[model samples]
Target: MSITNNGISIVPSFSLEKPATVFNMSIAKGRFSFDPELAFSLEAKPWYSLFWFRYNLSPKQSKFNMNVGTHLGLNFVNIPFPNAKDSIQIQKTDRYLVLEIFPRYKFSKHLTMGVYYLRSHGLDPATLNALNFVTLYTEISQIQLSKKATLGISPQLYYLNIDGNHGYYLTSEISLSLQNFPVIIKSTINKTFETKVEGSKPFLWNIKLVYPLKGGKIKP
Candidate 1:
């Protein structure tokens, strides 16, 4: 089980403007032990909301696993500075779509790897610029660092062509599982680099305490 809430700063890759602060929360859970199970996930923030449903295709095996999923979300951003010449920069909402699939292979008890591909698109009624997105994501994970901890690092490659933006980021995560309990406390840091920004974008920090109420562990 993994969960995270992010409090971060953002400066758009294509906009040379002051940075904005945003906060987001997420919850994810694997489903029943049966084959072809469901993985449920959700995200919410003052500026964004999202839901995900994924199909888990492996059960009772450890060598390989696969998943197919969909993410649907809404994004709201308010520009801090408003200009008379520029349209009001407040409360603009966009709808987004993300479809994904990934396959993972477990080399051994401690090592696993996976590559994920996501298609992201957004539609903005205010800007009249239909939202569209495309991204490639990949990760390698260490199943256990000791008896009580796990770690993973991932890199994301993005091409939001319709929004005229491109960027990439690397995320490092660590989780500590409680002894005699099902609780997990996790933290992550993400550093982003973008084509339009002069330097590295602001770093993001996320913390999540996850508890699975019911369900078997999902395949990666």
Candidate 2:
């Protein structure tokens, strides 16, 4: 069974002149996956959401593949983007029209390396007339280890640029698939080395434990 839960981050922030707490609460409707060679999905939370469409630029599922996509995301929560080394000045939510492309090549079926790039300069949601933040995001990962029934490890590099501000993050992630249950688990820990934004985090840690719902049920 899947349940709504609370998540904690070690990173600190200031909200309304007081330091913000570490806990976040949210709900999920479960996974919505697409079949066939053309891949894409839309995940909805309680609030506003976005759409994504992925088109394979090369062969659909090849050892060496190239793909491009767009993510339609909006920021309604006015969540502040943090800076690692300095205290940030809070701002409004940024509506995004991010363009993405990724290339992946596998040394073997179980091991792979890939890089993902995204660029966006967004509009203000309320008015939909103002444009503010321009950001670029990049992620690179290598699947160095894997166990079919256990875990997979990937060391990642994250770079983010907003307007002219920039930050770099190094992260490690583990994905675990259990033996008897239809559950997927993941954990990530990241450290930010430098940040141009003031309120950014120095370290980020997150975990996800959920059963992927398929066709109104958890798939085995």
Candidate 3:
């Protein structure tokens, strides 16, 4: 789904499925510099043959950063399904209108935290009116190993209240990097403790390859 080029900073991702289903490919670039306290990222995704762009802006200061962006092309009613062949019926497509604001802070050099809140409302084609509220809490950390290796970890908690249905989830990941290769080996474990009233707990294992682009500095 996601891949990084040889030691460079480019990340490319793609997903495709079933006949007339939703398909998308995206590329993103990020930059961090020691001067001016600024960081930026740009990404583009094509869904069902329609294109969309996302841009991010953040301050490079130790304490906090702000993220603001929007979506272009295709409204809700035209959103495509990625796995329609596996489902009995296709869900109505909702137009794309997103306004998300994220604020983050670093408690120490190794520990950082953030909170996010988003409000989205659109037409579902079938339902004709769709609305939802999402809230999330996240924490990230890094531990230095040797001169060429590092370890990173992140945990995320999410609460979603959609119409009358409510759900909550917890996810975590850990990664390690070696000096010889331009790749970082990562393993992630995620579990959803509970959803609604059902105690549905699911676990997943993932191995990821990471490549450093411009700023791969490790704090001592």
Candidate 4:
């Protein structure tokens, strides 16, 4: 979800599926001043997990002066079935855990990039005993705007050597602030396709209306 307070912004978002999932929290403040800033996010997936945090100390004179932080996550899974009579039926679940550190750099006002390294493990009692591996990821984003609206695009790539699987995704979103109403309309589309993976490819399309509960500097 995305929220704004007095023109400041905070977006807490997440996604999930059968073999993969993700969680994230991001914040932006002081947009109308020379010292605008942002915060970190926590994310997790099927064979990978990550905890990353960052802060902008100053922007007017030292736009690159920023503080960085890190954390780790672990995941596992288990599945069991009963084939005999008088046996208890059970469905196994998978779990995963990872330990990770976050490194990032800011190039300019509308661009930033980051990378992550993780030590990950998984457990599924039904088909396999336990699995362990390491993974690496990189992400990039760009924000631009016309005189009346804003647009953002982000793409991420990942490598999982243990499973011999590599994946990439592209996500695009746009929002427009209407002239008369106290609302902004937003929509997004995300696509992910893999070389050896089999299953349905997920697609998402949504339109959201957002406005402040309490009035502030009304956009004219």
Best by TM-score: 2
Q: After TM-score superposition, what is the CA distance of residue 163 in candidate 2 from its true location, in Å?
A: 0.7
Cα-based TM-score, every candidate: 0.57, 0.61, 0.55, 0.42
Which of 1 and 3 is the better model by TM-score?
Answer: 1
Better of 3 and 4 by TM-score: 3
| Candidate rank order under lDDT | 1, 2, 3, 4
If both were scored by TM-score, which would come out higher, candidate 1 or candidate 2? 2
The number of clashing residue pairs in each candidate reads 5, 7, 5, 18
lDDT of 4 by residue, 1-220 (tens): 2322111111111122222222333433442212212211222213323333344444556534433332333222222455755554453334444344444556665566665444445544432232222223222333335455555444434432335443444444556654456765655444554433233134534444455344244354
Model 1: worst 10 consecutive residues (lDDT sum) = 32-41
Model 2 segments more than 4 A misplaced: 1-48, 78-94, 125-148, 215-220
* Stronger candidate by lDDT (2 vs 4): 2
lDDT of candidate 2 over 1-220, digit per residue (tens): 2222223221111112211212122222222222211111112222223455566666545688766766566543534458645554454545667566767777675567777666665655443332222212222333334444666777666666655666666667577776677876766566778777556667655565656655444455
> Please, what are the lDDT tens digits per residue for candidate 1 over residues 1-220?
4344443322122221222223333345554211221122343324445566677787647578887877666665666455557565555667766666777777766566666666666554554243333334445556567775665654444443334544555555565665567776766565665443334345666676766556344477
Runs in model 4 lying further than 4 Å from the true structure: 1-92, 124-148, 160-162, 167-194, 198-220
Give candidate 4's whole-model lDDT: 0.38
> How do the residues 1-220 of candidate 3 rate in per-residue lDDT, one tens digit apiece?
2232211100011112111122234455563211111111112322322343444466456377656544422332234458766544433444535345667777888877777655444433444132343435455545768887888887767665545555666656678877787766765554555555222335444455655545443555
Cα lDDT computed for each candidate against the true fold: 0.51, 0.49, 0.46, 0.38
